[model samples]
Target chain A: MSILDSIRTALRAIAANRLRSGLTALGLVIGVASVIVLIAVGQGAQQGVQERIRGLGSDLIFVKPAAQTDRSTGARGAQGGGITLTAADADAITEAKIPGVVGIAPQLSFNAQAIAQSQNLGVTIIGTTPSYADVRDARVAQGAFIGADDIDRRSLTIVLGSAVAASLFPDGDAIGQQVRIALGPQGFNFRVLGVMEPRGGTGEQDNYAFIPVSSLSARFQFLRNPRGDISVNQINIRTAPGAKQEPIETAITDVLAQRHQVVTPDFTVQSQNDLVGAAAEVSRTLSILLGSIAGISLIVGGIGTMNIMLVSVTERTREIGIRRAVGARGTDVMRQFVTEAIVLSLVGGLIGTGIGVGVAMGIDGRDISGTAMQTAIQTWSIVLAFGVALLVGLISGSYPAFRAARLDPILALRSE
Target chain B: MIHLENVEKVYRTEAGEVRALDGVSLDVQAGEFIAIMGSSGSGKSTMMNIIGLLDDPTAGTYTLDGADVSKLDDDTRSKLRGRLFGFVFQSYNLVPRMTAVEQVELPLLYQRGTNRRAMALEALDRVGLADRASHQPNQLSGGQQQRVAIARSLVVHPNVILADEPTGALDTRTSEEVMGIFGNLAREQRITVVVVTHESNIADFTNRTVRMRDGLIISDERRLQVIPSSASSPDASIPVSEVGS
Candidate 1:
């Protein structure tokens, strides 16, 4: 028979047992859907994480104090007793004159209570210079932010985080307004100079207030030891365009080491670029793990297809015999059955892809807490899932198809 | 033409070897209508199967249309079967779901590279079942079903038609109608027809008869020619021995 005739015959045979064929196809659909959905979700999560990392300037680097050892035990550093990064270290970075050095902001953060009207909201207070706005891409929604004068003269000025401003001044403007902020054992009032634009919280820096570094050090007193010198908790550095980051980071490390008089590399200087790289690696691993789990369902679907095909062969033994007697070659019979299997799987793969894409879109549209993860259905995932499904169909269908083809005509004709 | 030389067919059962056709030799010429008569287990069916190329002989040099069919492989045997023989069975063996036209079309389909529908229609017309072509096997009478089977066999224009108890499951009147169709095909079309029947009455429909006993031909005889005018006249003399028997 011609290819068209064989296809028609195979379709007719499958149509004869509609319920069985549908059930077998359903198995493949579920299998392919599982793989598609899992991989899509994994890809979405990875994309979301990378987006968050990108949102925080890819070239930005963070430096934190490393562990300090106790002289008696000589084991490891005290968990909270590390030396602070002072403004002198920030100035030392300027002296090195490294190219691609955009901005450096010395930061000190502490939990404090801000009282406006009769309401009191506890929030973290971040103290940094004017350069923080450009480096962090922070924009003021209402009024102007703290400038170099505020950091130089220790002006009592602050900028409210979008969420914090909303809570403290429910119905009024926060700009040019004074809010009393009680820090630790002492309380002080600072004028709110600006209200930040709404940025949905990302990472660990949500619900905080920003103030001038000099104002924070002078008023809080705990921000400085008895040395009457400015102290910083951490330093944030933004790199310039087209400049290699590793060399600049090394220069920063050397500058901080000489200023702090620490012999060993006692601080952690991490590049945001490296963090992004690490996050991508983690996402990739997660996607593979999820894809494997989805692959299991595909395998189960394949087995189901094989099992159903085997049963079909047994059920249609007499039919096969009749066709054989009518001069159908063994290879022809094999081709017919295998084609049916592939059709089933391909249909399943298509349906699963639709369902998976719908699910990814649904999840992406919903509003949730923390970093908002984005989902994007990759074309390769679709191709891979469908290809795997087709392959599974062929692998699963071969044995039963071969068995049907090899049946003796006489014995099959006699089969009940 | 069909020729069998020292044909032997052995069946290997758990009990032991049983010879179905023990050194049987026979020759059938083209256009001859022959009936094979034997009791059950006398190997008449085995001989029919071997003749139809449905089973191979254990040891034989069987020639059909000048080719040694007994030595051919399965595929070659199948091809030759399609080209050389058409079959009718006691059960009709019409694919139950198929319409009469489809049943007739089957043989032509195996012949390949032919317009199956035209051949099938012509075959159905030859069997006088052109109008009943669309009716499935279940809708047709026993005689009509047998006619469809005959059409199926004749559609491919094979060298011979092989009938294995063609009327074994039909009523006496239906059997007569089926046998009449076979007689017309052999007489008018001059196509060879071989039938297997144990009934002596069934053997009378053929031009020649061969009776088997103990896997061997006990008697082979040609019937007396019928005068057409006497066959149609009421004053035709009936043989006294046949009437008394």
Candidate 2:
């Protein structure tokens, strides 16, 4: 038979059992839909993390304490322990005049309970210099940030993060208001100077209360390190425009090693690229894992389709014999069965894509944790899913079609 | 024209080997209406299968027209069958979903041709079934369904028509009606017709009869021809063309 005639024959056979054909296609539909939805969610999560990391500025570097690895005992200290980073290190790095040195901001923070006139809440209290706002690309939405005069005078003044302001005074203004912070039995009252611009959907950076470093050091002497100097937790560094990062990182490592009187540095420095790369690696692994899990369902669906096709071939043995008698070759019979299988999968795949895309669009919003959980479906994923479905149809239909083709025409004709 | 020389067909089963056609030879000329008559297990069906090219003879030279078709490939044999022979079964074997016209269009679908609709309609007209062309098999009577099958056979314009127990599923009246159609096809259209049956009355409509016993033909005879009554009826009004195919 001609190819068109074979297709027509296949369509007629499928139309004869509409309900059975629909049920057979259900497995494939679920398989393809799950694959699309899972990949979309995985890619969206990966992109969100990468975008947040990029918001930290491309030329930025972070320096923090590294845990000590003991050679003799073969045991490791707690993470971010061993050596303490202090404001003196920040000053010394600034004094060395490194080639790509631009600006440096040192900060120390601890969780504390804040008390207002009628509200009480747990908040992160940060002690940093005025240069922090510029270094971290933070903008003051109202009033002003901690100034240099306030630091020199050791003034008890504070700036609130957007979230902190919203919770402390839900119905009124927060600037010029007074709030008391208690850290380790030491209570201090500070004036709220300003509120930071809202950074919605950011996990941690959107909810901190900032104070000048000199004021926190004077009021809270317990913060002094074992070496008898006020210590800072981390240092944020920025590079000059068009400057290479490798040379600058090497220079910082050398300067810190010499100042600390150690052959190896006590701190770890991570560039923005390294951070983004790590995050991207995690997202890629998650995407692959989810895609493979969904692929298993598609395979199971294909197997179900094959089972139905075999039953169909057996049920139509007499029809096959008739076609054979009327001049149909073995290949003609095989083609008709294969075409039926392909049509089943192709139709199911299309319907699945529609459902997947609709579900993805329905849940396109950030979750309660302020991390976006929305899906982003790529064009290539849709195409790949559809192509894989077609391939599955062809593979699963082969054995049954081959069996039908090999039946003896004489015996087939004798079948009722 | 058809010729079979010492044809042998042996079938192997778990019980043993059984020879269905053991060195049977026969000849059928163009425009000849013949009946292959035999009792149960007399190899009449096997002979029909071999003559229809649906099975291969183990030791034989079967020639159709001028070509030796005994050793032809399966696809080539199928092509020749489609072009030169038509078949009708006892069950009528019409596809359940197809209408009468679609059933007739099936054989021509395998060949390179145009005007398929017109040809299918013309074949249905020849069987006096042009008005019932839109009816499915379930909607037609047993005799009408068999006439549809005959129309399908005629659509291919084959040189020979092979019918296996064509009237075995019909009543006395329907069987006579089917036999009359076959008679008109042989005499008026000059097409060869071969029928396989065990009934003596069914065999009387044909011009020749070959009787088989065990696995071989024991008698071959040419009886006096009896013109079917349908040829004289008013319903046999199919147009006669001046050109012959």
Best by TM-score: 2
Q: Per-residue lDDT for A86-121 in model 2, tens only?
A: 888888889999888788888888889888888887
lDDT of 1 by residue, A1-416 (tens): 66665566667666767898888878878777777677877888887787778776657888877777878989886533575677767777877887778888877777889998787999988888898888787888888888889888899888998889888988868787788899768888889899887767363444779989888778876777567767777788889876788998898888888877887877778888888889999999999999898898889888999999899888878767655655556676688788878777777788878887777677774666763646667788888888999999898889999998888765676577
Q: Per-prediction TM-score, please?
A: 0.84, 0.92
Q: What share of the true interface contacts does each candidate keep?
A: 0.09, 0.55
Worst 10 residues of 1 chain A by lDDT: A198-207
Q: Please give the CA lDDT of all the candidate structures.
A: 0.79, 0.84
* Model 2 alpha-carbon miss at residue A290, Å: 0.9
- Model 1 iRMS: 2.6
Stretches of candidate 2 off by over 4 Å are A68-78, A81-83, A183-186, A201-203, A220-222, A366-372, B231-245
Residue pairs in steric clash, candidate 1? A68-A77, A100-A240
In CAPRI terms, where does candidate 2 land? Answer: medium
Error of 1 at B118 (Å): 4.4
Q: Write the per-residue lDDT of candidate 2 for residues B1-245, one digit (tens) a residue.
A: 79999999899989899999999999998888898999989999999888899888988889988778888888887788888889999999998888999999988887888888899999999989999999999999998999999999999998999999999999877787787888878887888999999887777677788999888999998855445546323121222112111
**Model 1 lDDT tens row, B3-118:** 99999989999999998888888999887888999998888988887898877899978888887888777667667777777888787777656789988877555556768888
